[model samples]
Target: MPRVLHTAQALVDVILEIDELPPRGGNANARSERWYAGGAVTTLIAAARTGAEAVHGGAHGTGPHGDLIREALARDGVILSDEIRPDVDTGYCTVLLEPSAERTFLTVYGAERQITAESLATLAPQPGDLVCISGYSLFEPTRDPLLEFLETLPEGVDVVLDPGDPFADFPRELQRRVLARTTVWTSNADEARALTDLDDLEDTPEAIRRRLAPGAAVVVRDGDRGCLVFHHGRGTQIPAFPQKAVDTNGAGDTHTGVMLAERALGADWESAATRANAAAGIAVTRHGTESAPTRAEVDEFLA
Candidate 1:
């Protein structure tokens, strides 16, 4: 089995660089246009770029957009799972970038939203594998499949959870189950606060730790403020690498991918989070969601 067995969506992204976001019922002009692959694949590719053996499997549309994402994944040489849905069209997102490089995404989840338990059962994760679970999946209507899949992970397979959306909206029981299975949990600063009702950033990790079993790590990432990693009952803050972020589109996904990759490779928490920070730092400096740094690029950046 690959070190990282990731089950998530990979969709094409349509990028429009605008001076500012348009007001509701208003229009805006674009400075430029670009198309690239994006979404959960961001995490898988970022991890694969680190030279870790990686595999991605999930339902995706078989449309032209899916073709774009498929070609992109092929170029990276990532192993793919045969769970594609040919009847539906792949999802795509329109990413609007402001002058400050912040992004606003208008997404329409497509074929990928049709994930089911039968498809997920195809994943044969072995001992020591890391199965990436995204909150995006939880938002889908097929909760039964997701619950079943999570409950069925092999004993040696550990879960790394990234509650991808609305931390507050996540069902309490789902959170409870995932936290129980999670070996490492990642969330943004705001999500962490919402989930734990903790204000002190330093205190959030501890609060999260209380929910997780011992030996699990909680990573609270505050964009530009850096990140905190809590493992074995101790927390360490790792400062973000300074960069002129051109687009903040997939920085968090890049961080997640790199971190998972490093952990699967036996790196300690500090080392993995540090490398993930560097990888995300490089990602935001470039354009497009597939902008994760390669192993050479990350090493060069660190050097």
Candidate 2:
């Protein structure tokens, strides 16, 4: 079976439940606070729960934060590549959750951003594997090494690119290089629009497809309205199972992870996307960054 390999950062998420965003000069009080393993960990955990063999190939620190990330990954059966950085601690993201279930973030980088060709060599991606990457990895220190490693992927390996909220801000040249190797492009509707520069939401998927490698697939996820899955000159809308969302931090990652897991498990794009939609629906109804549903839970929800 093809493994779901992640080449992205996993950070500790310090979540604060607050009433609303504070003014620039003001501060808001939090009703509660919690923490969880986030970032790439969300995707890997979702993939692992969906029965895919998940592996994390990013650098981690040799401190408390890294220990937390490692524990969460291990709990979910995700294999961690042996690339622990010495002395420094892993990074963290401070997430503010409002009553609306919307979230704002402030991140602090650490050892995870120090990826290199030597560290990435531990991943040793094999042909037929689905390697997942996030847009965050395109920043400075980490970008060059990751790009270099990507160029050496074995034939038949599938690169799954999840363009996060900041994807539009990445360098144009960097975007081109990554898209040239991306076999699967998964992101939200707004991101799809940004990538294709299309006003019509319906046209962005096809336009985005043109930007990727030939025979690439596109998945445009729209909250409540479901998602668009385009591949092989065909496009289909996979309906979403909407739920009352509480914390939507990891919803998109859950969708992408489940989609890749299903694909690795031999499901067609459409079927995999349908299951992914169900998983994301369940994820939003829960709390925290690791809210993705297990395979049995997803199956029950679909049934």
Candidate 3:
């Protein structure tokens, strides 16, 4: 089976549950608080749970936050690197979850951001591996190193680009460079619209497809409405399996991970996407960043 390799950061997520978000000048009290390994970890856990050999190639620090990340990855069977950043602790994102399951985030940079091409090369990614990249890594200090590392990837290695909410904020040159190397483009509906600069959401997928290299694929995830998948010059709509969402923080990551895992296991694009939709459906119905379902759970849901 093809492996799913991650080049994205895996940070500790601090989740605070609140009745609602505070206004710009106001303060809101959290009803509860918890911490978990998140960021790229969510996707990796999802893939690992879905029977893919998942590897986290990103950097982790030396403190409590890093310890939490390593423990979670190990618990989920995702392979983690032994190298650690001794000088600084791992960073975290403050996640505010509303009663409606909406989430907002504020992040702090740490050792994970201090990446280098030389360090990443240790992963030794080979042909037929699916390497996951996120728009968040396009920032300074890590950006150049990641781009440089991507340039050296061997043929047959698939680059999976998951442009986060800041897709439109990235420099045009950086965007073009990453997209040029990306073989699989997966993102949410708003991010897809931002990428294509289109007012019509219906046309965003095709526009994104045209922007990629020949034979590249695109998946635009629309909440509840399901996902739109474009491959080989054709588009298919995979419907969502509705579920009552309690926490949606990692739903998108769950979808991405399950989809890639299915692909790595020799499933067709449509079949993979359908399972992904089902996985995400199950993910949202639960709490925490590690809420992704296992292969058996996904199969049962689909059945």
Candidate 4:
């Protein structure tokens, strides 16, 4: 199996359910609450289920919440590195879920945010491997080290970058450096607009393609409507699989994970996107980050 290296952190998410978002100085009662293993693990699970070897290339956390992540990854059969941090406990995110299932997040950074060069070196990406990086790691504390890591990546590995909501307006120069090394760039519609300074960016995938690093593909995901992929000057709109969505948290992660795994195995763009679409469709119907479908589940959904 081909390898998709995820140099992302494992976060323990505390979920709180509320009726609606309240105004300033207002309070909302919780409908429910629980903890789950979230963050980049969703994408890795989706990719691993699709038959690629999933690797945790960064320092897996330690201590209380970190233990939960470790156990979940073990149960899911994800491969971990020796980069486990003993110096600090894991970080966590407080996710607020509304009645409509839309979410608002407040995070507390812990050990997961720290990425050392030595930890990254253990993965040793090579030709035919796929790398998973997010703009979250590029923002502040980890920016300099992460940049150093990206610059030193083995030439032939296909690098895939996803700029989560937090990275909507990432610095142009850093974005350019990442684009230069990225094989495929994935982002949400709002993120696309914010990053490109084009309010109507979705109208043309060409603009994204033109601004991308050489030989890279631009993938802009439009929730429910589907995702658009631009490569070699051609645009392909891969429609989302229709489903009654209950929660939207891990859906995009599932899609990116499945697509990256499929691409790593040499699958064509359309086919990869379609399968990823199905995986996300199944994910939304269920609850939580670990809800991403298995390979058999995705096949059955397609069938």
* Distance from true location, Cα of 283 in model 3, Å: 0.5
Residues 1-303 of candidate 2: C-alpha lDDT, one tens digit per residue? 999999999899999999999999998999999989999999999999999999999989999999999999999899988668898999999999998998899999998888887777688888889999888888788889989999989888999999887888787888899999999999998899887788887798889899899889999999999999999988899899999999999999999999999999999999999999999999998899899899999989988
Best candidate according to lDDT: 2
lDDT of 2 at 184: 95
Backbone N/Cα/C clashes per model: 0, 0, 0, 0
Off by over 4 Å in 1: none
| Clashing pairs in model 4, backbone N/Cα/C closer than 3 A | none
**What's each prediction's TM-score?**
0.96, 0.98, 0.98, 0.95
Alpha-carbon RMSD, each predicted model: 1.4, 0.9, 1.0, 1.5
The candidate with the higher lDDT, 2 or 3, is: 2
Per-residue C-alpha lDDT of model 1 across residues 75-133, encoded as one tens digit per residue = 88877775668678888899999989878888887887777776776777887888887
Task: Give per-residue CA lDDT, model 4, range 39-153, as digits (tens).
Answer: 8888888888888888887666669888888887777788886567887888989999987879999988888877876677677888878888988888667777777888898
Per-residue lDDT value at 81 in model 3: 51
**Top-down lDDT ranking:** 2, 3, 1, 4
* Candidate number that wins on lDDT, 1 or 4: 1
